[model samples]
Target: MADITTPDLPHSRHWRFSLDIEAIGWLILDRAETSTNTLSQEVLSELEQLMDPIESLAASEQMRGLVMLSDKDNGFAAGADISEFDDIAEPEVLRAALERTHRLFARLEQLSVPTAAGIHGFCLGGGLELALACHYRIAVDDDATRIGFPEVKLGIFPGFGGTGRSIRQAGPVDAMQMMLSGRNLRATQAKRIGIVDKLVRHRDTLRWAGRKAVLEKRRAKAAGLTERAAAMGPVRGYTARKMREETEKKVRPEHYPAPFALIDLFEKYGDDPLAMIGHESDAFIPLMNSDTAANLRRIFFLTEDLKKQRQRGSSFKRVHVVGAGVMGGDIAAWCALRGMAVTLQDLNMERIKPALDRARKLFQKRLKKRHLVDTAMLRLEPDPSGRGVARADVIIEAVLEDLEIKRNVFADVEEQAKPDAILATNTSSIELERIAEGLKDPGRLIGLHFFNPVAQLPLVEVVRSEHNSDEAVARGASFALAIAKSPVVVRSKPGFLVNRVLMPYMLGAVERVEKGESKELLDAAAVAFGMPMGPIELMDMVGLDVGKSVAQELGHDVPEGSQFNELVSAGKLGRKSGEGFYRWEDGKAVKGEVPEHADLQGLGRELVVPLVDATEAAVADGVVESPEKADIGVVLGTGFAPFRGGPLKARADGKV
Candidate 1:
């Protein structure tokens, strides 16, 4: 190895330039005042300034190659700074900014010296676009190394020449799917898909790999012949049509127009890379200004805000869940998956086996590596004897929702649990104070209410009662964060926040169903209104028996001889029982067609008004700390239409 030479360029704030004796110039991105690097306007401006020095070095013929990497430990860059998006109210301003980025990246791409991106951690969105501009992308093959264009998640597609370059490198179908879905690909997956040129197993070797690739003039993998053929006019049109159809099934064109716009762009210009690159801004600027984009960006920030609520000093490692039912089992599995040592207790191993089976499936899906999956699985133990209580940092009782059973379970837990261990209940509707009765130290008891399908939902209402110490509440919220859940601190009230706000909306749907409105029409209306699932389908998924129990606990008016009671009595429990308001097959609702001439007008508003009202009432009643917390709870906990922001936000915006 030869000695390195430092460049005496005008002082750059965000980028550092150095030239090795081998003449491999290194441009390290080290955005100041941030733990993670984002391509903010200031950072980009500094990058553009540094480009003059880069061009000077290349023009002098001293720079043999250029290697770009990040100085941040977490990732290369998290894409363009999303905070900057909020201030750009005009399309022309956004378009001008996009053009600046394009010109900068184009200069990098057209550099005479070979360029390589030494990627580690997350190389996402604009970061990925920057890498795509490079001659080669050498990625570190680690869990943190994810590569993708994720701008679609913000309701916009990439505008900095990514649309054309990604298609050229990975082919049209793969590129379109990547942009349309906004899904990140792991390092190995990126390499396999031709988005990445090389993968090194360790981060220390990333620069070495990039330096070698750049010095050797290593060519990136080109789109395969089949992929190239798919980009032809007729083939591209067929592919785009199929993509549009699939996208429509998941989201409507009116609700999410970015994906549709991308499809249109690709279909029109898939064969012409320069044309696609030139036209990307035309498509991107409009979507960036859409209401859906604004709302989705708000949601992105809301989630970021929720992340800040994680208690600073608190840490929870061992979790003990005392139930092998759906909620308990799934909760335990998720805890284990998030790197906690979890013990799931039940009556016997027979009851525990199913939970383990579900955990195995979840592990396989998430932790793709066999060793990783095995490691996660090993963290979860089946403790039918309830012995884990003594060692757990947090012991959650997810037994039957019955108050007496919960009380009895806690009384025993209090006897065996460690003195400082946080005690919690997974009860959706049961009041924490009532469940805290008979506990020796009631102040230690808090509510960590996880929603159903525990692995999927993000919100965990950390219910704080009058008796709970603030420290205990903070620790409870911390534990939720430890398991990768958003914690909404709520006053311990009936049905807490999410379920309480949700019950009225769900019950209203039931009343309408009983009033001769078609179940399919009711659900379709809500789906059109932006709810993930219809109220009727959601009810079936929640289980008729459990829904009735929560509704009754909340003191809702469930008249005798109602359809809800009739279904429960007839053993048509719901998706669990394979029957309810709708039939269930392979875990999906089987719905019949809506009757002709059935009034569907204002049905969505009619169903959601109660939910919005309940959210406002909860905020007013102090069930949650603020209207923002109420919105976060409802949006995250219930999957309230994210594009509407939340029920409260929708109501505030007068969308309701």
Candidate 2:
């Protein structure tokens, strides 16, 4: 009675390959109506016409090895479908579709017999360049797997043949700092950084251990004679002049030309895996028509269409949280590190044991087991009795921004929650209708704001309030995409959309340091106008009295009688009182001299055109519905400049 009509596909005419298993010739990518497998230039032209009859069955011996699985239960592809980069917006049809995906990964690296891949979930970017032209890969000891080549977070690089098979198997400074810090790793750190070649421990034994490491011809695992003598030759010219002086001190190779063209095409093709696959298909065909990789592939299809329009099909078991501080004990230890049973109340049991010792030091720096931070502190309970907000199913309220103490803590969380729970709020500058006035069902409240060390920023915002309810803004955008974060639904104004487009670029860098300018020429003109920390050293690392009380709680203006109230009346609260406007010492930021006629590109366009006109006036005042969710809420809540994709596509490409 529970069969659900859809099980006839062992191989009904190879929809994205399916050879099954004649001693592991599995192939099977399975992309029909997709739930993950990506590489779509029509699935790399039907995987190059199904690898020409499996390369004529490995040239007649009827294939002894080949795996590349993924009938998607998790995901093995997740790459190459920047919605087919709008049908190759011509850089010679995106370098002839990246030279037909490098002649189908150089015909699966000249497969004569053994070839592998397996992976379990998210083998990213051209699916880790088809598991590095397969000769082995394996993966699957799942915490939902992960391997990499995150195409430099979509501003592009790793244009298939993943920068010459991750610098010929993990050399060139840990494969160019894992493709210039796009960072995925975790399949036991991609098998200790040789980008995985075996970690199986059952995902149905990754296609029988990737066909027993391709009929025991294993090979693929190189780089260690001290990572091939620290990338060889004159220590590869002092590691390509210290990765081009640390990628031009935070990217400015003419505004992000794919991580300085993947460190100048691997310092001009050293370790030549076929000249780094023709300089990664001529630097990914004009960086796939760069407007910074089409605004970082339109913020990777708007955070994958806001996780399918914020699904509210319910599933957030328990979760209480009410103010244990440090953003409610890191949002109750990131909802007990995502499995959620959380609780964390806090009438101070030493503030709920330092949010259970900062959620057991964030699950001992992201779980590789200290008993999975004791199974995420056995789902972090610590209530100190508000009776876990009447058996919470979502209560949040990380209190103390004050609007009558968050309307008397939402009238005692609408008198102890759960009448179909959900009452969110982590208020990063209030106004979800002023914390839903005196809430007794301000349509079950909402806002889920979360962003300050809430397990290291991935922007939550959810907001919504005209007294919420479209089922409480899809249950606060389904508990901020069920703890993984990225939410962005916005609209309850006053500093809602990323602190109202970052309180006019931090009160216009404190009115250019009270009109004299030099916080080292406005933090080196916001790291030469790309900004990953500059507006007065991000308001002295977010504490010039918490950026002047969020620019006077977002009403903004802050000009008259200034030097920002004489550096907050001389306590100089920044870097925790080390001193504001530069003087932190051993903890860095030591700025001083900049009056060599400090125009600094007109003070970085007067602190980036009022943060690109307050993100096109927050998509023209609906507070966020387009200009791609106010440029993915100021590029994931005020880090902005994801190669200038936010701030209304850097003010509609005039690049602010």
Candidate 3:
């Protein structure tokens, strides 16, 4: 409102306040910090500071209605600024903060006239909670505009009266699912489910949201959004983050206090929306303060950062796989998903079927989701005897790890491939330079390593050898991206980044088992240490044979006192062979007879320490531990727990 601005208040967020004599007052909720306004602590404080404006105006009969809108192109408000949660201390402190926020929202709600939140662009978490606090909400119908409380993912939930408010407005069923799943709702879907009072197209937003606010003459009779959100489904949703807490329950059971504190705030203070909202504001203290959350957040940002990273300047458009076994099938499927034409080849049909089948399933899943067209599967083709090798821009050799076999595949694939084609090996154990030596044009050779079940894992290892050209490295990375994977370039060393670190860790784990450390204790301790799977459990997934092979690749001098290789020789091939450190029955891992302890490092980080502090201290100045090598080996070699960010990072974090 033109008449509403405090003469002394600074306009730091680039917001302008003005009142319209036309009866509908206007306030542009703009923030200059970024392109969008995040409902940060400062924003909540500002919102509280401004509440007196409407109350004072109404008391003096200066304004009849108010329209809260964002001047920015794609947002109303993106909820509570999560950055504030970075250093929260205690649950009580968090609760106090929520109480303060509740007071702010309550003040805004008590206006005698009417209030409306005009939402667009990422109406998520606290942002949507703010809108729910308003008397009425109008959203612009556009793909960019979405509504959801995604706090559950971070082991938190909408603390700003969102669970209660949305439940009241949308009723129990929809409200519970919305918060629990933290699923997004488009404006159209929002209207259908009664989550939004009204949906307006982008052009009609101001007019509709403003008119709807002034038109909403009736005072909210019962508890609105928060009340409804708490009462949904058989789950009997509470004013707390019950919907979201379900995930936390399964994910962090041992760390009950972390998730429970969040739920406790909601259950304890939710009755009065104002009180619960106040409680909500302070929730960040315990939620953010906990070490569990800290670790989870660290992991979250770590992997998320990888996803956002790109291969600098290079772009890969085509990829070719030189084998069609389970690994190659997964590789091809991943390529197709990321908008790449993948030519999967095998020496014969025996190997070809597995790769083709894997790709077929991957594409079928996409078809079900409608993310890829049903016709996209036609792009995948099989080449027995390396027929498509020459036409490919990048060729990945997914053949066995056998030295002679890998060398032979390289020799044949090189002969068939174009002069400029980047030849890569999916070999997990073989040294890249040695295999490249088998090629005439060694400069064209590199390692394009993918994990088994490539469609799922996000990592790919791009091995750059001395002979490899920058062009080859660039394309290898591009192909990794083309397959929708995170490619971390590593040095041309045996076992690459992940395994190099992992060898010692595994040897340590096996040694621990061999040393009479109870399997259950080791697993429990590791789990408590935040590893997704314990060492022995991991060995089962990695296939005893694969694990032994990688260990052997690490050489006889790799680590002393681990009998895993001996076990592999004794017929334990891990999950596939149904025996390793554990037994596999019906696709699930079960503890096997405790093998004799083979303890290597004893306790703590002594077992698997970081080789060198600086890259210069290690093998070379620029060696990267391959996430691809780590992920694939973990997935294929030992089932290292995909969501846990693999053993390389885990070992580094655990060891260092």
Candidate 4:
């Protein structure tokens, strides 16, 4: 066995940072008792303490340069620990903490020996921030390695010098976007942006990263990494300000404190990397303690929790898509693109070939981006008559949302399908219970309500009808995992989850139009509130005919105010018909005044209240048993926003 464990360190503050008496300065950063290390207060404090050891080692002059490496081998640190911020007491406390972290990071940058960071795995947020302070950064070119400043999603900016450092290192535009959007960058992309000094594949990672640091330290040019920090000065300030404004566009409640706090801190010290870190303390404590922050953090944890819960230690190798329409073709493409073998089936050659063509073009685009390989072609097979169903383990049915159409198809597909193959249905405004009614293997009939344009929509509602066995739900969840879709479980109901929640909102929008509020005015209010698309525009995009049919079918069991009927009757079905609440011509929705024959523009908002109140009361009055039940219908079946928490929350808040 080889020797393990670092010498001269029982533990050093937050972690044990020690230097060995090697020819080159080798600093070992090992934080114990964690699968992935992160920069917490204790960890940051320990890092500050590491400075004393460094000065002491430097005095003896035993080493020429420093090579940074993790002793734990658990993987590079995954940025800062998010939970600590969730419970912080106050803004001042956060600011003070940031100040302390800034001081430590500043001292590390000033180290006499040129330093290099050997990074692997997730090098994100504060972790990437720390590496940027070093003179050189070398990383393993592993597909698993991820690097980025993903603080925007947290409703904050990179506080520990990441904003300025990334901007200076990658140039103003790249760094500004990195902070504002929080999108993670992989190895190749990271190298393109000048964040990575060298990216070596695994075989040569250790040797290359180590030797490169030594060579860089020996070069006179390596000393100038700090000098170039001021290269894009005016542009840097402009980009930072522009990014702040762009972020404010998305931050709700207008008066929310986080964005303004960031703008203030960056305004004061963004150009000075060392000074900027200290400013973080002020924003951190206040944002950490806010109720909005609390809610957002809870939502964040819920998202990660859902992903893990759905994954549940299971996987899928092969999946099947039935029907060759838009939904089926997209589902097949998504699955095959995500590395699962897909067998797509339709009634005949013409329909099957079209779907196959769809999947082929989708993968070809992926291939162009190097996101897919040749083997992906072999994984996707289209059949006119369910040719490959026997080899498929999961079959997603995307036939039209007609009861007879689906049940009839399932009856024959059932005979040809494998015993354990999961049967997933992509039916909108249809009850999962009724679809499972006539199946011999009803236990396998699970609902997978993927939104239209399957490849783009992030949500995937997994519906488990009463007849569906737990195994079927689990298998469907596994298939979603294999395809990398965000999955949520929902109850079996018409318009199962998302659609159920949306019906109320659409009804409210139409009611507003009836009540003298301009449709455009109401749409403006929705935009100001942070919806991806306004209700009226969305209704038009969905088409009046389809919207009317779905509303009539779904609203039949609920209260009145079926809003789409009049619009459909007047031949205004939305984008499909080129006219709706607004007229569409030349591929744009030109805002229109209330129609002459359909004038409800003088009614009161009471009309709007009735639809929302009736919906909430319907839930309480046995229309839906509970908030959870009604919510499932809204979320999965209806396409409601997940961040809102559900219809019950919206109802209780008088926002329904």
Candidate 2 on 1-656: residue-level lDDT in tens? 01112222333332444444354466667777767788787766777766777777678775676777778887788877777687786888778778878888889888888888888878887888887898778787778878777777777777777787777787778778888888888788878778786787778877667767777878686666777665566676677778889877767777777887777777677566578777777777777677877777777778778888556468778888777877888888888888888878768688788778877878998885888889889888888777888888888878777778777878887986779888877877777776677666686788788777677788898888786767778777877887888887888777777777777877777776677756777767766777777777777777777677777887665554677767877889777678887778776777767656445555575677887887787778888877887787778777777766777667666756
Model 1 over residues 444-487: C-alpha lDDT tens digits? 88999998889888999999999988888888888888888999
From the highest TM-score down, the ranking of the candidates is 1, 4, 3, 2
lDDT computed for candidate 2: 0.76
* Tens-place lDDT digits, model 4, residues 1-656: 12224346435634544334344656555666665778777777777766776656656664556666665454567778887884445656666667677777777777777778888787888889888877778778765678898765565678777766775677545655566567877778887777877778872365456656665673212214443453346754665567667876765434245656666666666566446555566555666666455545545665555566464656577887888887888888788888888888887778877776777788786555544555676777877767777777787889876889998878877988888777778987787778777788787788888886677776777887878777777777667766777667766766655666566667677666666667776665554443455678778877766666677777632233444566777788888688888788886788755333232222322223433454465465443446654544443334333344444555565544
How far in Å is the alpha carbon of 556 misplaced in model 2? 14
Extract clashing residue pairs from model 2.
none
TM-score for all models, in order of appearance? 0.98, 0.36, 0.71, 0.83
Candidates sorted by lDDT, best first: 1, 2, 4, 3
Q: Which 10 consecutive positions of candidate 2 have the poorest summed lDDT?
A: 1-10
What TM-score, to 2 decimals, does candidate 1 have? 0.98
What is the Cα-based lDDT of residue 214 in candidate 3?
77
The candidate that wins on lDDT is 1
